[model samples]
Target: MGRAAAAEALTRVRKTLVSVPNLAKVMANSPALVKGWLALPGALSEGVIPAPVRERLAIATAQYNNCEYCLSAHTYIGAHVAEVDAEELERARDAESFDPHIAALLALSDAIARGRGRIDERQPKARRAAGVADAETAEVAGNLAPNLLADTDNEWPVVTPCTHN
Candidate 1:
C-alpha cells in the first residue's frame, strides 16, 4: 500500500484504540501489517480471558522479552485501565499472581514468550492442574503475541530511508 493507504489505516487504528501509539505509527508504513495488528487483540478480547488478565500477561511477556517500552506501557495500562493494583502489577513482571488460575496463565505466558511459542508438554499439564482449562491455557499465546510484537517493534523499529523531494 502507498502512503495514503497507510495514513488511512492509521486513522482507523486511532479511531478504534482512541489514540495512536508510536508502534502503530511505525507499523503504518505497511498498511496491511498495521491493520492486521489491530485484529488479534480485538478478537482475543472477545475470548474467555478477562481484560485484566490479558494486561497482566502483557506485562509478563514484556518483562520476559526485556522490552522496556512495552513493559512500561503495559504496566501503566495494567494499573490504570485494567484497575490492577500496584503489588499485582509488580507481580505480573515476574509472571506471578495471587490468584492461582491467573498465576497459571502468567506462567504459560512466560513460557510461550520465553520459548518463542514452543513450550514443553509438561507445562500444559501443569497449567491444567492449576485450574487453567485447555482453552484459557491456549489463549495465553493470544495474550502474549501482541506484547511480543510491541516489544520487538520498540526494541528495533522499522527503518525506512526517506526519499527527499
Candidate 2:
C-alpha cells in the first residue's frame, strides 16, 4: 500500500485520536500487517463473545507477556468503553476472572500464550461448561494473537496516546 492509502485507511478505522509512532513504523514496513491488524478486531467484534470479555482476554494476554503498551491501552478501553470494573481489571491482569466463562477463556488465553496455539483438553471442557462455544473459544484465541503482536512491537509503557487519527 502507498503511504497515503495506508494513512487514509488508518484514519478511517481509527477509534481514537492519539497516534502511535510504532504503528506508523509498522505501516511503513508492512502495510499488509497494518491492514490485517485493523480488520481482525472488527471481525472479532462481530463474534458472539461480548467486547468486554474479549478485552479481558487481551488484557490477560498482555499482562502475561508483560507488555505494558497492550496492558495499558486495553485497560483503558476496558474501563471506559467496555465498563470493566477495577476488580475485574485486577483479575484480568493476573489472568484470573470471576465469570466462569471468562475464567475459562483466560485460562485458554494463557494456554495459547504459553503453548503457542495449542491448549490442554481440560481447558476447553471448563470453557464449554461455562457456556462458551468451541468457535468462540477459538475466536478468543485468535483475538489475542494480534494483541500480542502489537504489544511485542511497541515500546514499554507505550508512550503513544490513545490515538485514532
lDDT of 2 by residue, 1-165 (tens): 577876765664454325554654555445676667767887888888788988888888777776667777788778888999979977887678988778877887888888888877787677778887888877977887677444246443442322221
Best by lDDT: 1
Clashes counted in candidate 1 amount to 0
Candidate 1 lDDT over 1-165, as tens digits, reads 688998898999989988888888878888888777899989888999988999899877777766677777787788778899989988887889999989999988888776777998899789878988878977887776676444334432222212220
lDDT against the true structure, each candidate: 0.79, 0.72
C-alpha-based local distance difference test score of model 2: 0.72
Q: Give the number of the best model, judged by TM-score.
A: 1
| Residue-level error in angstroms, candidate 2, position 56 | 0.6
TM-score of candidate 2 versus the correct structure, residues matched by position: 0.79
lDDT value, candidate 1, whole model: 0.79
What is candidate 1's TM-score against the reference?
0.87
Rate residue 137 of model 2 by lDDT. 75
